[model samples]
Target: MTQHRPDTLSHAPLGRESAYPEHYDAGLLYPIPRAVNRAPLGIEEGALPFVGEDEWHAFEVSWLNAHGKPIVAVARFRLPAQSPHLIESKSWKLYLNGFNQTRFESRQAVVDTLLRDLAHAAGAPVAVELLDVDDAALAVTRLPGECLDDLDIEVTDYTPRAEHLAVGEEIVEETLHSHLLKSNCPVTGQPDWGSVLIRYRGPKLDREGLLRYLIGYRQHQDFHEHCVEHIFTDLMARARPERLLVLARYVRRGGLDISPWRATPGERPPEPLRLSRQ
Candidate 1:
């Protein structure tokens, strides 16, 4: 097993689209190879490291017209999990900013162009909904304070009888805990930090292996949502748990903290546990 190291990622302004590989198709959604897999470490099941979520920044972006006037277009984007190209969030942000200086004859043109560009970039079917910014209602805000760091954690050396345990089978369910800590932009190497939680019920999972897997992402570079999904899928595939829930509550960045949860449609995730930046 490799020893953990302090993160040393640096941050810089966004760059051109050509800087990244064109794996995602503009018309489809897909998954890419993850940092956890690339990292040098042996990951088993239970002892996965935890990284807090709430460390991302989305500018609550607005578009401007050629006359430098603000133009409001509400959009909802959905990218397929199987798309070839995974549009980097920073690049997406920059791409959205580009529209600020450009002109579109109508709101529909703006929406269509954005959907097309995003879909093409992701290489998957990307969905977008356009509404008047003033009329569009934002999703409910769950966390409303400076990120809290006070968490009562209980760490147990979990041992699974099976080589792998089933997912969502009370793998470790008690108080909130973080597994791994990692944050980085693929294009600029800007680091984003967060804690992760894995709750499951089935068979007992291997604690040490899970920890190793979490620590393995120390040097990984990926977005928060992608990271959470990657963790969820990896566990599902490796453990084959009967039930599983992967929820990441990232610290706030740019006035927004994204929390992505994936589980059986009917399953309900616990309330968000907001963590402070370490």
Candidate 2:
């Protein structure tokens, strides 16, 4: 492994030239300190405004057994929002690829090593699980709620505008979603596509305005977790909803997809759903 250390996302090796290493190297993983992006959201000091966790599904995990036979498994990692850092996606890919030729004593041992390594990289405890492809769920599902894409509206702005989230007193509960939630990577400027679902109670949010606000993220550049937190904070500040649940499911890049979920205090997260695009 190289001794180089990168401090920012742009300095990371995602868009840079690289080849897979021949051995397992824990140092291959890079972590982005949460404070870097959280600072801009005015959450640099105190407690986070929401409760949730970021879920990662790795679809391309493989390694070798003691007999030189190939072993394959899917991995799921859940990183809490309170973590001090988030693992860089490309670095994660490199780290996983490093395990290609390595042998483990047992699946549990592999799981334990992965848990320890990822948790250390994230600066927080991360829950991890390994599943066989035969037993893993593969159903393609859509976000549950009303589809806002059918709304008739004209959109010209492609930047986040908190003013677009208008709400009125109605005390009704509804779930709204849009498949047009797209953003760009802060480093490589690569387009990130995803679907977002908003479930809330209190004053009803203007569906047209909500769709416009989601569309505004077209040119936005930020991390997936930061984007979800940004949306949650915006809604809390503007609509003042009594209850809110925000989720962003970005498509898989580099054989991995990230799902960030935030909800009102004491609320359990919904079932994990896989989409065709994921």
Candidate 3:
């Protein structure tokens, strides 16, 4: 029952080779306290300015049926932003791999176990949904609003610079997106490609400046959740939007994809729309 803090990154099985477990083992799940990153963002643990969740999609879920035959399915887990901790991505992959040889009576049995273990690790009630590999629910959809990738602009900076974000005097509401969002993994230093969507109300954000601000993350190293929070914080400070929503849909790595969204309170969150890249 030991909880992991940010300093425990070295203990995580992310950049190291690991022996895949052949049976169920919830111990593989590692919880990294959210406060570790929030503190740096000036976000208090209990007094968060935004309400949202991290939606995780796993495509390599598998386990043995009662007859010892293998059953495979995809899974979606919705972890609230208020959760005390966020499950480390690599540890989550390892935990799921542990079910490869485990047997369950029915799909419900598998779901119940997942609910119990994941909720315990998250320190919050996590929504778990298992769907057949070909379920229509897994259909891909496009990101809302306009794509900023086509904007002709120059970008020499690779590090995040919030000052690049500028808002005009005109007030408006719009959704903007960019597929060039890229950041490196803090542990592995591997690139994490994603599409970022920004929806906001208030002063109009300069599209070119917004793209530059996002492009600034190209060489940044951080987790998906932290990156989104950083963007949200920057927008609120520089653009001064009345209401804002920041969503990052990261491409899948190790058979898992994580999409984290943060929004001003009372703003309705969007559906977990699967992008073509996912």
Highest lDDT scorer: 3
Task: Give lDDT: candidate 1, residue 221.
Answer: 71
For residues 1-278, what per-residue lDDT tens digits would candidate 1 score against the true structure?
A: 11112121222224433333223222221223333342433433233332222222333545555565877554445554344434445445445555556666667777787677766655556666664545424333333322213333343422222223233345543322353556566656666666666666555555545654555555667666666666766776677666667766665554345555556444445542434542
Per-residue lDDT of candidate 3, residues 1-278 (tens digit): 32444446778888999888777888888888888888988999889989999999999999999999999999999999999889999889988998899989999999999999999989999999999999988899899899999999999999999889988899999999999999999999999999999999989999999999999999999999999999999999888888999999999999999999999988865674899999
Query: What C-alpha lDDT do the candidate models reach, one value each?
Result: 0.49, 0.87, 0.91
Count backbone overlaps in model 3. 0
The list of candidate 2 runs beyond 4 A from truth reads 1-6
Measured with C-alpha atoms, the lDDT of residue 15 in candidate 1 is 41
Clashes of 2: 0
Q: What is the TM-score of each candidate against the true structure?
A: 0.53, 0.96, 0.97
> Residue 6 of candidate 3: its Cα lDDT?
40
Of 1 and 3, the candidate ranking higher by TM-score: 3
For model 3, state the Cα shift of residue 107 in Å: 0.7
- lDDT at 237 for candidate 1? 67
* lDDT score, candidate 3, position 202: 89
